[model samples]
Target: MERIAIIGCGGSGKSTIAKQLGLTLDLPVTHLDAVYYDENWKPLPQEEFAAQQEKLVAGERWLIEGNYASTLPIRLAAADTVIFLDLPAATCLWGILQRRWRYRGGQHHKDGVFDRITWNFVRYIIGYRKQMRPKVTALTAQHAPHARLLTFTSRRQANAFLSEVTTSA
Candidate 1:
């Protein structure tokens, strides 16, 4: 329960869940979005992103939320558990729509300055994940060989799973 990885498609509530988990556990949570996306919605160089993440993850306990496979293995190494949000494509889009709606209306989704860019960035959710699924599944198998992998196809299940995690899950 010391470290955890929340893996899922874009707009799949990975960051939100990780934030809540951090509050529940009172441990530091790393939102890879913040690390990967700089001001103006520009992406940090791979080397630079890796370096920044490498430094942040050196901590004894951390909860990393992201699906950037480039350096997922490194973070997964120290993660005691891996939570995968396995919602359907339509469901993912719905969540993204709701999230973007909130962002557009200045309700949620953190920074509002990047709300306009989110539309373009999110167009690849399905296609990208089609290619990313194999890698994600492989890593899930590789990292937590015997650890629990929770798949939620519905909001009910996802929320229930969170409610069930009483401790450092």
Candidate 2:
């Protein structure tokens, strides 16, 4: 996998998997959150964000992680592989809580600011499968038909795939 795009809900471990894949495959990893959000958690202008993504994807190899579905087509067009973390809402909620605890009072490497587990964020995670999954599914099918698509319904499967890739590599 020279070029990979990892997409999922807010707490779905996209960044974690991307980092692991980057290390295993010796590919550069790009966290779209870092690209899109300023140090203060302010978002870049839409045009600027798109421009940045355009430049990143122009590179020969990269593992870009984010769920910016609107801009997914850009990365999808460039990637040779796509991974979708289709974990349950409970798992994702647990992940967010765990992350908040782990990174409390400090900024996460992939996040723009210190972790904050708000009710709105929780609600978004809870509703993601019903609301966003279909959209992502259609977009991937439409934009990256030739790309290798791998969907993991649980963290165990994701980790197994990572282990398999690492061993094979």
Candidate 3:
């Protein structure tokens, strides 16, 4: 509840959930995309990115949303809870489309962050369950076994969980 790591494919609502949970729990939120890329979409170097994540997780309470699987262990090891948005591929694709429409001008609601739809992003969403799930599952098991793991298979389910958290908070 205090320290959370949210992971899933693009458009899985990871940032949205992180914002909601951060508000409900009175914790700071970090949208990894905001930090990982500059306004012009230049990436932060890998070493610096990893170091920055290390500093972030050292805080007393935080909710970080991202799927940088390569740097996942840093957050996972520090999290008290891990929320995995495991919605179906079709649902994710639809979400991405809706997001693109919502932010049609390219700039995201997040400051200095831009949204771009690429073929690779679409293919990643389509192949996520088959390709990324196993890796994420294993990483969670290995790095955050003590953390509470919440996996939501649909948007409704994720919303319900958020409602529960809000009530409890």
Scored by TM-score, the top model is 3
Against the true structure, what is each candidate's TM-score?
Answer: 0.83, 0.95, 0.95
lDDT scores for all predictions?
A: 0.72, 0.88, 0.88
Pairwise TM-score winner, candidates 2 and 3: 3
lDDT of 2 at 105: 44
On residues 1-169, what C-alpha lDDT tens digit does candidate 2 reach at each position?
9999999988789878888899999999989888877667788998899899999999999999998888999999898999999999999988887877778744565543346667888898999999999999999999999999999999999999999999999
The sequence of per-residue lDDT tens digits that candidate 3 reaches over residues 106-147 is 756453234688999889999999999999999999999999
Q: State each model's C-alpha RMSD to the native.
A: 3.1, 1.5, 1.4
lDDT of 2 at 24: 96
Sort all candidates by TM-score, best to worst. 3, 2, 1
Q: How well does model 1 score by local distance difference test?
A: 0.72
For candidate 2, the TM-score is 0.95
**List of clashing residue pairs for candidate 1:** none
Q: What lDDT does model 2 reach?
A: 0.88
Cand. 1 TM to true fold: 0.83
